[model samples]
Target: MKNLLFTVFTVAALFSACTNDADVKTFVNANGYTIYNDSLISFQKMIIEDGKVRQVGGEELSEMGEVIDVQGKTILPGLIDAHAHVMGLGFQELNINVAGIETLEATLDSIKAYAEANPELEWIQGRGWNQTLWPENEFPTAADLDKVVPDRPVWLTRVDGHAGWGNTKAMEMANISQDTPDPQGGKVIRDRTGKATGVFIDAAESYVTQHIPAPTAEERRLALEKALEKMASEGITSVHDAGIPAQTWELYKKFADEGNMITRIYAMIGGTGNDFDELSKNGPIKSYANDRLALRSVKISADGALGSRGAAMKEPYSDDPGNRGLLFYEQDELNEMVDKSVSNGYQTNIHAIGDRANDVVLNAFEQAIDEFGDQGLRHRIEHAQIVSLEDIPRFKELDLIASMQATHATSDMNMAEDRVGSERIKGGYAWQKFLDQGTVIANGSDFPVEHVNPFFGLYSSVTRQDHEGNPPNGWYPEERLSREETLRSFTLDAAFAAHQEDVLGSLEPGKWADFIIIDRDFFEVPAIEIWQTKVLETWVAGDKVYGNSD
Candidate 1:
């Protein structure tokens, strides 16, 4: 379920591009094109052989190979979601998607509907609920959910995935009560009466999720299948699987061995400190299934999310002045762990949100690099969402990657300034600032948090506005990236983050035969139409994997 191509050229219209006369498939007649090196290239034809790019030239080159027609669509490097959850996307489809619902009633209604439809489910699981979109912007209590599905456990993750709201039954199943102490780096929000509101934040969310039944292997395999299919349809050829448990990584390997792998995954072995320690001792898993999978990265979390009031902050919150946030580790502890991991050659990707978290992580990265020297593993700080103004350039100085999500900017614009205050907001979602300093900003949609659509990210990055073109101008117009810059971030720079730049990321010679054909010229189209540009065909390794099925 990777990308696919359509409108196959009649074999009679082509010849071999190379003298070797190997099995060659030629793609020609694109209305506009771009490759890794240039935003716009003069070439109109490309040749693929043995699942690798063989040649790219003008119409003359097209005459040498069996021409495959693109029907005058725009061709681009298959988009890579630099940071996304692979299986989370599939589960989003399998379970409830309460993503764009505008009101509280709609959220409860969705849960009720899903519960009614799947009565056999002991626990109704879903995500993408945000109180920020609600009328009062107040957290919903368990009583609100109890009004609907009170029989079974209901666990709904907040849109940011940093918090969870559960029904009374769910919390009871976990034995959470007013007396239950919040976990380190987490919270169990309470009301004026000090009753458990059934809202868990950051690490505190484990209280309920740990009790939820794990999906069966077959179920996981199916979710992955569904996930890859969804990814392919979106013109996503490859993704950096944000973090997954060992079982999930093994499941990915099983699929790769079965030759069922379509969407390429650069997996990060995910777990708690113990799991990470064990995995580190066992060491990284570099390549599997002909490089279709690479599990050589470790994911760590520095703090919670800003929306959940869990992200570690240097100062008190602007809106809630009395409350600062939680940090998962002390500076030295985090530094020691990161230093060892990088010294072991594993790409350490840390989830850092608040300025304090970013600052701490950045300092740790600098210390680790100083101690170990550069391993060129391109260690990344995921969701470098809100770096302090003083620490913005530290990303480039330390050679640490700011693996960010563009959609997060537009998604958070509504409540962000209110949370961080106007002065601190200057450093939040500062993409253009990073770019100007030559920091390779790897962009993505932290999928399952935002939409999986890369175009939405592209739209957000270029416009710094939500899909409806809100705020008249962008929320922070000065921070918007150029169209070419955003594309490069999603493609080449994304590959660079995964250490796959030489093999993927572009439609250049000697690279993987990965490219996507879209319905509209992304560059020439009006900015408003950018998100409307649909994937007409997606191809991986010269094989078509998706067409306009609908």
Candidate 2:
């Protein structure tokens, strides 16, 4: 019966029978929940007018335009993903994705099927192959791929996006050989006899990937649309696109100008290459197209990921002795980049996954702040995955945000401790430690790297466990976040990270009418069942953007 009522509203929205944006519409009988004044509040009635919340209360308010009862549905502020790759997620959907394949044999079969299905694709391109998940837990070889995809060149990126697996055809096309020197901050895996193993890590991926044809403008538009639709359906109304190349920024602008954006995007321009030089010169764009788009942040990659043993650690890996991880840039180079970004009035967000990388990023950020005085720009460290215990408090002291992906902890639990060992592991994905030091964490899923569903992140944050409930006591149970903390991290706190807290984040009177009606109350659901919660309707700026009617 509740679903029927929800469907009715959705259908009405589709035909323009719903209240117009200019009119004051009262939504009644809703179990509304939102974070306000650092507390979760409940409201039964709310009024929305001109794409903003007008009033919210426990009792019915005076009706001004139209009254619609949501029939006792659960409503909450729209989830915000603070660290996602928008274009990458879109491409993952469009290409051959083997994200969840349990074994190498199955993964190969899946790849073979995809190649056979897409016969027109000259180069078979895909991502989301995790070598660690295979039974043998070994990186795949060119021979392994050649058996399945012999004719066409094939390149598959690891799930972390820090490594790439190329078939013999692809490597041959790039003219890779045993003598091919490793690029700075990157490596080409080699066998015992110094022969290329067809695996490229970090910067070396560019050699093989440069040959693939770039997507046309129309293709990019389609991919963006697909990503927006997916975000809407999952109840996400806003996304902090972690990094945007110049081409993606142009596409996002087109969508915003046309008012075609389904989810609000807070984009961070890539802080390197010709795009950075071009975009940053004009300064930051605080807001555009009715707050549907904002480009005021710069994203810099300081190091690689932990999955591929590429994260820059202070000490050598526990599993692989005598070898620490890689840092993408030297200290002086990173300091200059951060200083340039903050000086230009941009919120700088750097990706630092290992202890050494984190240390370097913190130093860079501190130097930038000292030179420019922070200026109220909330600099962030994306994936503060591994940190020295001594450096953890520096986050709070410097007023920097830890833009973390909760699911990364759950996903990396199997190997994180193995890589860093027991003692250093204490500061790995240390949510409680950050919170204890008064550091704010902006949570996300790093979608396509993990799953796109925000609920997956919420569950992981609160439970500190895998979907199947591994380690029953939770992996590092001490680091688990409370339900309220997790919700705030994804909603209000995330908005704060993007500097959109003034106009977004909550159901307050002056906030944007961006919220969602879900099937279950997130606050009341059992911790283990949080991931099962589904979105019944998603509203952005008081308009239904996605619903079950679709």
Candidate 3:
């Protein structure tokens, strides 16, 4: 009886040891305080089991097997860039970046130097030039580029990515002339002499653009991969690719299925006739590859950009009298597209910059909602840069998302005031006002238009300051958002915009283990220093996708 009792005791001890080991497999130390990673509602004590969050704080804590200390590092949800053009990055790097070039002479000089060095290339392509940044702020004549590249055709796009400035050679090659009437929804900037001045806005630029060589498929793939890597490194786990081609969407699907896709993509099909037709026929594709990719929206360009003076404003520009900007799409056509998209189960994301443009889009969306009866469609207004106070309420009433890029507010602050004057400034980039009314904002850096660094967007949203924090106080201080609001715009709200709130945008149990470790806690730091914060590590699904230490 004693020997039997001893054997039973030994077996019980062995079983208890196995149970402890099993518990160890599920432990994670959150270091006491509850983690409000993405949204405050998602606050929990995490149990990291097998590299993924297994359970939240509860009775589960005592049973949690082992604990791995996260120390005191504040872990937030992995960020999402709500609006960006990712494929454009590689092209921007390979071609000339002319967005911020201040002087026509300097722009020509840069092109001339580039042409001289890359004589083997077939054509010269560059983007990122803003005439507003120039001393004269006047459109440059084709004569300037002609003098530099008379032997070769040159095309450089303005900073807003809405217009193009071409040389005389390009105009001749495309058969553009004084007799060529402005295409519908476009303008060919001409001299008082009735000659083409090299600046083409909206649809007019496409005459030259359509002729330029499209990048090869391999080129597109490589550029996308490079852009994804950069996004992951910055702790951006997802992005709403603002205007993507159908072909690019195919590539995204291929990559996602193969597990090569590193970031969650909410792709808004570029509103080309082909893209609209294809997406409409098939209907919305929700959460491909376990909620990694989504395609349910169409992006429509309502008007051009403010920098190019093509943003259809309520009043004429403060600087350029008699010009209130131009609309890219006809009103009737826009309404039709919205109606068709809503009927076909597709959301519409319209880019509207100037006050007038914002009004136009808001009206269209209102009409759609009236007819369609708000089926929880999170329709979006991209940019919404300059708005009227009256139109602001419409965003909430219609349940439309304010898909804004915060960097645009700070970046354009210098010239925006000069363009719109004080009366209009109140409604421009009014983030705080929108939030007060219970509107969700999805923030991003319109990359290639601005830098893709999410920190810059966060900094600008919180402080309304430029990188250097000049001018003593921030720009439009009343419009600035708090740190929490800014973070939510990049994470939780952004996820909600993309219809991905369930699986991502929060570091909660059973959700994908996606989070970023920043060098400093944004909440604790001085507002200005937020711009200087660096991403320490980026994780996706419990795997380290990018890390400085790794």
Candidate 4:
């Protein structure tokens, strides 16, 4: 009797769904394309039912639903950033940012202007200062910031977020002194006279940050909304936020519950803090609130970034001798973390920039998989930046995902070789090397570090050059990815990395009807003009989220 009732109920539900003509909509005159079974498939029209794709092909219009004409616009699957910081991107816009400033003097001028404008705040907080861009080509000291805003406690972070520059007043408030010892896995830059230089690297940043006030929930909410708006405008319908604290996790939940989320988020617990202990106990939130949000991964930092010379290399930096760089954890400690994450049903993604850090993370993942088994979770190494040639093949062998940033190569091209030298550069930012070995490379902007534009990544991936088109043929031209390979990295491959390919990556049948209408065909755009590609309309779940209405 129970089986009979269940069968009747299932049949009734199916009948009801099929009878709902109001739920069906057809989009016509679209030059639609999506990756299907590792191949690009094209279609002329798409039929959607109940926020899911029903079919996408050139069939005579027989369905009884509203027919909308897109006027032959190009449509592609929504771009997904495999690794990025949502809140960080939001705050980068909300705060007084100094990114793209050409010189130290100009940066100071901007800082001073911002301080004067916002004198009501107790601490002047800002970011996006890169000393490499300055004529000096050196790290900016607190002295540089002091010359601008001496009275206010100015705290500025470098573009990489691995280092912090604080005014003397800010350091004084933190009680940092010459006698203060550097924390393990971090460094406090000091002068020849043994005095604090007001620059803190990695773990040492806590000395000052601990004193800075945390943003209120309301502030975070605004920041998130701002980030979503930015992403929608850029055609990013989904983003895998690399790390989220408990507060961020809570905010994401709140947004999802309230139906306020415009872009899909795949969040990861920040393993560096106690958020893991509190958040990871429930296993993982595989999907939530109609798949607008998911919390199934944990982000762990293995080492700092290369720009700060804090990346853990097997050999000492070619420029900074006697410093191979700092590792945040020993082999045993990292193994335990990886094992804990995998055993708890979390996809573990570790940030590894230098060769030594890559080696250590690879070992940790191997041990964890051997002990706890991967559970087919597809562990990843974020920023697989300066890996050794020998360890390159391990990515494919371990069935791991290399979550990499393309613009990093173009942005770091000027100084990367100076840090690691000739031989190591061969393996550094080698996207083609990983692709050739059958290893999946998921692309991202690492936004707020690099620009949030996916086209910048696409352009950089193919040309291996900056916006001005440097190095002619390209930087290490042989290592560049083809256009198809680059798009796959940012789209379907990225979705695979986040374990959401079945639902989000492609605009195929049964998947969420998430796609974007572009101003021009991405495939037909010139390599140099790729970065300038404009998103005409962004749609999620068959609803237009961002676009100008005609």
Q: Highest lDDT: give the candidate number.
A: 2
Which stretches of candidate 2 lie above 4 Å from their native place? 1-22
Q: Measured by TM-score, how close is model 1 to the native structure?
A: 0.94
lDDT of 2 by residue, 222-241 (tens): 88989999999999999999
Query: How well is each residue in 475-542 modelled by candidate 4, as lDDT tens digits?
Result: 99999988778878988999999899999889777899999988877777678888888898999998
Q: Which parts of model 4 are misplaced by more than 4 Å?
A: 1-20, 59-64
Local distance difference test values of all predictions, in order = 0.84, 0.89, 0.79, 0.88
lDDT of 1 at 143: 94
Clashing pairs in 1: 3-538, 3-539, 4-538, 4-539, 4-545, 4-546, 15-64, 15-65, 16-64, 17-64
| Better candidate number, 1 or 2, judged by lDDT | 2
Candidate 3 off by > 4 Å: 1-52, 56-74, 99-106
In candidate 3, what are the lDDT values of residues 198-304, reduced to their tens digit?
88998899889888888888878788888888889888888888878778888899999889888888899898478778755767898788777899888988888
lDDT by residue (460-489, candidate 1, tens digit) is 888987778887798889999877788889
Model 1: residue 127 alpha-carbon error in angstroms: 0.6
Instruction: Quote model 2's TM-score.
Output: 0.95
TM-score of every prediction relative to native: 0.94, 0.95, 0.89, 0.95
